[model samples]
Target: MLIDEVPERAVRRAGAAIELPEGLLVLDADSGEFGRMPKPVADAKIRGLSFDGARMVLVGGRGTCLLRLADGEQCWYGIPEERYDEHADLSPDGRTIAILTCDEENAIISLLDPETGRRRDIWSDPGTASHECEIRWSPAGRTIAATYMIWDDEMDDDALSTVVVDAADGRVLAGPFIRTHLLGGWLTADLLSFREEYDDLHRLQRLDTTTGEVITGPTIPGRVWAAVAGRHVHEVDELEDHHAEDTTFYTTDIGFADRRPLFTLQPKVEVRYFFLAAGVSLPPSR
Candidate 1:
């Protein structure tokens, strides 16, 4: 009897900070799929996400955590007093990290030097608080676009709005645009993105940071996740809404907004795995 040779396939280790429709789950993008990151720590309700194209930084509840894929490591960092976590983003060059902090009484923006783990108090607003939905920086890192929602206990409504802040002086440059969220925006020399409700199903809208004019995308259904730039094929899994305890992980597309069902990913069947090679050392940040 004789055996034939079979080629070996390489496995990639990956982890994802999944923003589920109802809850958030940090699952092993490779394997160990069912093992969910604890609910409370996962912050079932994540306001925003920022990826420097390498590590991912997650901000929610009262803390911010940094996660890496190659080694499967996580680091938790807390904000200063009177400053509750809201949303965060990385600077264009990826040297500094900015976070919005709210206290119920007012809102402020702070910047952290990731290399040194040092934070600087940048801007503060006494009259209002920031909307927790989204916060982003422009390509130059000179301006910030923040969505601000107003909470009215009497009317029982969350009114939508946005503000453009000058990073240098912390001054409101544009507005307080009223009644909007779920924006697909970008920061060039100019800032552009569409602002719309979940039901409106807005396409990518380009915005002018100086004039506040918008160029809209084609109308579509459902909410927009992230923007895709090129022709890279992606597998998506549209998972049904799940409660914190019952569900493990669901399927979704990588390029979901394109309206192209190009690929399908089954979490269990199609997966990746990471194993420690003998004598390999883990870094202190992990």
Candidate 2:
């Protein structure tokens, strides 16, 4: 089935907020209609959405603002003068927000209280030059995982790493694992799945935060987009015609068996990221 309501050029900036050139279109999944379209701010960029899809974080030339989708209420959080490429993720409960900010010499992770717009710096990489910082809260909101690409002067190439930190106090829990990138989902509250590259291949693996154990899972195809919830994998099917007017999204088991068509979009939307709604249950992997 094709969804004509979705604009062909609409980009999923983060969460349920679809990015248009002028502003954002909030999709109400339950109502099957577009919710209030928030007015565009100067150089507005959608950062992320709350777990329940009722609120979103937007950053622009002025600063960062938290917008409530139901009533258009806005909460402004001042932007740091030294920060560049700031990214934010709302906690599952929507009370706390994890913000990652990077500059030429350091990357800083901080916690923000949405109610009062107060912020506390939790973690910082003092001398490392880092960018593309992405942060996510664990399912239970007890920990946060941050993945970022760093300039590896020793290797003379860009490398990736993932770090897990205690959400309450920013205690380093498991990693700043080299060459590992979080796959955007946790298998369990303490078990995180990520993509590891070695021997010229990319493989899926899980890390145990409590016991510091690593479990290698499976080798992922080059075209796979992301491994979600440790159960299903989403990928672009290269076997299908790439130039078709409609684009199909497919999901497979963890092992890449039993592929199923999830949905098709007319006019072919170019998607860089996809997020599942909160509390959506997926079938067990075979």
Provide TM-scores for the models.
0.60, 0.79
Clashes of 2: 0
> lDDT tens string, model 1, 1-286?
0001111222222233333332333333344332333223456133333333334556666466655534446566677776677677666566767776667666667777776778876666543444435667766678877765665455577665666778876787776656655343342447545465443454445567778676665543333333323211222223332222221221122223333442222232322211111111111111
In model 2, the clashing pairs are none
Clashes of each: 13, 0
10 residues in a row with least lDDT, candidate 1: 277-286
- Model 1 deviation from the true structure expressed as Cα RMSD, one decimal place: 10.0
Which residue ranges in model 1 land beyond 4 Å of their true spot?
Answer: 1-17, 20-52, 60-62, 126-132, 151-156, 187-189, 197-205, 215-218, 228-262, 265-286
Q: What is the TM-score (0 to 1) of candidate 2?
A: 0.79
Question: Per-residue lDDT of 129-242 in model 2, one digit per residue for the tens?
Answer: 233446778878999988876666777877777888998888898878777777755656677778764535557777888898988777665345444454554645444465
Question: In model 2, what lDDT does residue 208 have?
Answer: 86
